[model samples]
Target chain A: MSWQLTEQDLPDLARGAAVLGTGGGGDPYVGQLLARQAIREHGPITVLDPDELDDDTLVIPTAQMGAPTVVHEKLPRGSEPVDALRALEKHLGRAADATMPIECGGINSMIPLVVAARTRLPVVDADGMGRAFPELQMETFGVYGVPGSPMAIAGERGETTVIDTGADNKHMEWLARGVTVRLGGVAHIAEYAMTGAQVKRTAVPRTLTLALTIGRAIRQARERNADPIAALAEALSHTLYAHLRVLFRGKISDVERRTEAGFARGRATAQSFDGQHELELRFQNENLVALVDGTVRCVVPDLVCVLESEQAEPITTETLRYGQRVTVVGISTPALMRTPEALAVFGPAAFGLPYTFTPVEEAAVGTTA
Target chain B: MSWQLTEQDLPDLARGAAVLGTGGGGDPYVGQLLARQAIREHGPITVLDPDELDDDTLVIPTAQMGAPTVVHEKLPRGSEPVDALRALEKHLGRAADATMPIECGGINSMIPLVVAARTRLPVVDADGMGRAFPELQMETFGVYGVPGSPMAIAGERGETTVIDTGADNKHMEWLARGVTVRLGGVAHIAEYAMTGAQVKRTAVPRTLTLALTIGRAIRQARERNADPIAALAEALSHTLYAHLRVLFRGKISDVERRTEAGFARGRATAQSFDGQHELELRFQNENLVALVDGTVRCVVPDLVCVLESEQAEPITTETLRYGQRVTVVGISTPALMRTPEALAVFGPAAFGLPYTFTPVEEAAVGTTA
Candidate 1:
């Protein structure tokens, strides 16, 4: 169903998108501010149901590309996403019928809403990745044969680059990452331009609504003084991410994080209150794998998310620090993201993890309840 | 006036371009081979005098961008320059009326000829830089208010990127350089699209003819058993680069060069045959400064060219090695290139050298005869 996303919706969207980010995709708070400011200036944006989109509707997905740590400090000018959309429109020689999120996670989810608000184009209720992955080519749209170019990238200073490397999505990612680094470690990009029919077939549908639901559930649970993590799990049970489990409830003991090559890459270790068990989380922008006592319990395209222990607020990878009480949660990814072709693009092996693909549900079986 | 650049002319062009390259631009022999193959397959190209161009003529300059060392080993597929031109033309929405060299030095001088031969577009006899400089924004075209983008870069794999970063040439260069590195250390680019009037007003004119003259003089001098160095100096006397002086005649005793950040950069030291003086040449892709016995003898916006002591063959920075008999030559840059405006972009200080902008002639005035 079509809906309108006003300034009031940004908080829930950002919070939910943070959960979907799996500990990357940039800070949701910053995204919320940018989106709220954009909506205040340009009015609420219409959110179009992907199913209702005409087959020929030109849909372009917008996102921010860079290290979350950098984005946190170097806030965008708030016009980069729209500037990128306009540049892409100029390159494609067509006006976009609607805009969408390439990744329905963190700042990326908010970026398309900003574009839609500024352009008065509806945003499709769908995204290429139901949850975020660091690289551009990890999108379900790319896996299903959508070219990542002619992609447009815009910097804070109104500089724009249009990349049209034919059919090599990985090459596009490599080139775009390099450009992002040159643009002060952050850039807004509009890419994977697709028709509505392609979006309907390949995109993870209703991810925006799913994020809103998760965010709303967490808020309501906190308001009622109930367990927010349980509410978050209850919210996911009704969505494509049908399985959610707390892999570890502990205080962060160590975080070996560094920003390198435009990514916030590192591993964090958490120790249980009893000091008897340990959990390690590895991430490159987004959390990629989780190991409980050296046994793999979660691997991407599954989601390994770290949340505040009581309030269930998502903690981005960049914000992970020593001595934080947190709950590490693992949620099964959408079935569409676990297919062999999709897994080949973003599986544990793709991230150099020497492990076979296993659902978070299966990996979590017989672990701590 | 216009002239046909046949396959027979390529040797002279490459040789002259090597001298003009000022020790960078990629190896001239590789460029000669690429141009020769293109001409043999497609036909000779027309070299149009810049003055003959109509005001409305849309001209684009083409060149290779990367470390000369990389180009030597990973020879282009010979279609990259043309691919870049076509991509730029598509972006600009106008077919090019002519093509030109962005730099009339090194392999870049031959790159435009390749594009022209394949596309059947006349190659302009003028170039942005009469002699090579390492960075893109160092061009006279840019210094004199020409934008370097709406540019196109193409990889050997037929991948292409179009950068249209409004009026920020340095930003354009930064983005393009990053893209070049990601494209495996070498790329072909078409940039600085200008009108014929802009070309006639800003470009260093008749550089192709000058390269040809230098090449012919050296070749004929060798044939007649004459001193090629003296012949080379005689050749420069008639061109825009009217002052040429041999700074040092020595054996290369020490060389420190490495390919880094998509550029061939380092220093080479040559000791005089008498062992009384030392000449140090510092280069980044192209030679930028020459210091003789700790005194500045040359600085860029001028040419510091290294040549074989006897044969007078230009030796690129990448080929500098220990124990090679060589002569270092310093030639004055064009008057247009030494203006206060031009110096601000490519002067010694721009390269982090602590020196004032002194012409090569003035710097060499008190040196040994």
Candidate 2:
């Protein structure tokens, strides 16, 4: 499908991306503003399905890396995303034909849109990760044998670095992370550049439209005075994200947060409204696990989203504060994420959790409207 | 003066460089061996006076970054220096017609020679710093006018990173240091690239021949069974390094070491052979300061050299050990480094020393022979 993203779509895209961000892509406010401003200035953006691109067309993924605490306060100069793309293009001595998101969650998802709007380049419908993960190498692109560089990391502070190394994808993540830290713990990186056919073969397909639909569903539910949670389940169920369930419903009783190694990390404890049960959430940028009363209720590769209990507004992990009323939703990740190979890189073990992963669908039933 | 460096020059060059290294720049043994091997295979290297170059010719400086312990143990793949130069060339889209040293001290001084041997590009007689100062921004080039990047840093693991930023020279050093740490605590950096005219105006003139001459003086002193310490002071007094003195003479009694921020850091205490006095030496990569019973003696912007008491071999801080007899010599820094402005950056205050700087010559009487 080919689509044009006008300013009107910004709210829904940011909302859905926040939900998909599963608490780690960082706050979408800045990303949303940047995208809106760019679109308003440069006209609507043409978003293309990966297949719409010719085999030789070049596509690059754009992302902002840093602790959410830092990115939230130190807004980008807005030129960063495009600057990173141009740097990558210069490094290649070839121009990128389109832009794509490295992940479908948080601020990262919106970055590509901003670049596409400003450059009037087509934006790819797919992303490297169907949902957000904490680090660069956790994407399906790496698990499937694609190298991350020639990647470019450009900072708002007039620093542009290009790395073409024989290092493995994980090492590439470390190298990029180090550079981000030096650039005031925030930088725009355009990496994992691939040809259009490689994008089709490796990227998680159509997450952009899925995010828009998910955003629209919850908004429509609020308008109709229906259950937003049920609307969320149906919205996810209709897409490749085929399983959804509310893993916990509670009021946040306690929360701990620490910004470390360019990540917003901590645990959140939500107490049951009935005072009989509690949910414990562990996160490193994104929520990795949810345990209810010492029982493992959800684990990755599965999407764990925290939403305000009544408003159903997506509460990213960075925004999780004490005394908030919330419901945690679990959606089975895209099939590409559940493969044994992909699981090896992003499963519970990869996050240093004790238990192995279990599909959210297998762990719960009757989760749809 | 234009000259060709035969393989026989490697020993004296390494010897003088180690002395100038002033207990930093790591062991030149490996660098010397590498240069010897390259010269044997690629034949003689042309060494050029900065004035000999056409005004538009490109000149790049090459050096290794990181702790001596790690570099000595891991060793480079031998291609890193050339690889870094080539990467810089590719980044600039202009081939380098000549190469130079960022610092004419320790292992860094030997890098340009090795590169020159391999590429047959003339090695410039001038260097960024007449002596090493442990950081990149401390170069004379940046203080005068030229920007550091279009600088390229290449790793032995086949990684080449180019950093192009409008950041100040100090920030460039920090950024490059950060990258070096990620590339396994050691990397080859080709930075402060400039045109031949810029090199002639900013570089410390004839520092290469100075290193070789100094090396030959100490070696000849040992061969003649004369006082090597006196010979060293005489050799330095005869050149632009117009002042020299023995700051302390003793046997190593105690040493402390720790690796921090990818730099070998520690203090060594040398107790006088007669047992009345002791000198405390502190270093980060190279010797930064020396104190006699808590009184400041030699601070940065001046050269501090540690030599084996018997053989006159330059004992770099990395190889400092208990029970070795040694003489600590101090030489007035090049006139460029002693300026109030330059000292403000590489001075005693810059390195966190408590007192104002006093030139070794001004502080010691009858210092020159």
Top model number, DockQ: 1
In order, what lDDT does every prediction score?
0.91, 0.85
Could you say which candidate leads in TM-score?
1
In candidate 2, what are the lDDT values of residues A1-369, reduced to their tens digit? 798888898888899999998887888878999988898899999999887889899888888988888888889877897899999999889988889998999998789988998888899999888898989889888878778888889887767988887537777788888989999989998899888888888889998998898889999999999998898888887799987888888889998999888888899998888888888999998998888887777788798889998978989777788899998888888888899999998999988899978888776553221
DockQ values of all predictions: 0.88, 0.80
- Tell me the tens digit of each residue's lDDT in model 1 across A98-202: 999999988988988888887899999999888999999999998999989889999998989998778889889999999999999999999999999999999
Q: How much is B293 displaced in model 1, in angstroms? A: 1.9
> Residue B194: error of model 1 in Å?
0.9
TM-score of chain A of 1: 0.99
Find the number of clashing residue pairs for candidate 1: 0
Off by over 4 Å in 1: none
Worst 10 residues of 1 chain B by lDDT: B360-369
True contacts kept of 1: 0.95
Error of 2 at A123 (Å): 1.6
Q: What is the lDDT of residue B84 in candidate 2?
A: 95
For model 2, what is the alpha-carbon lDDT of residue A307?
Answer: 91
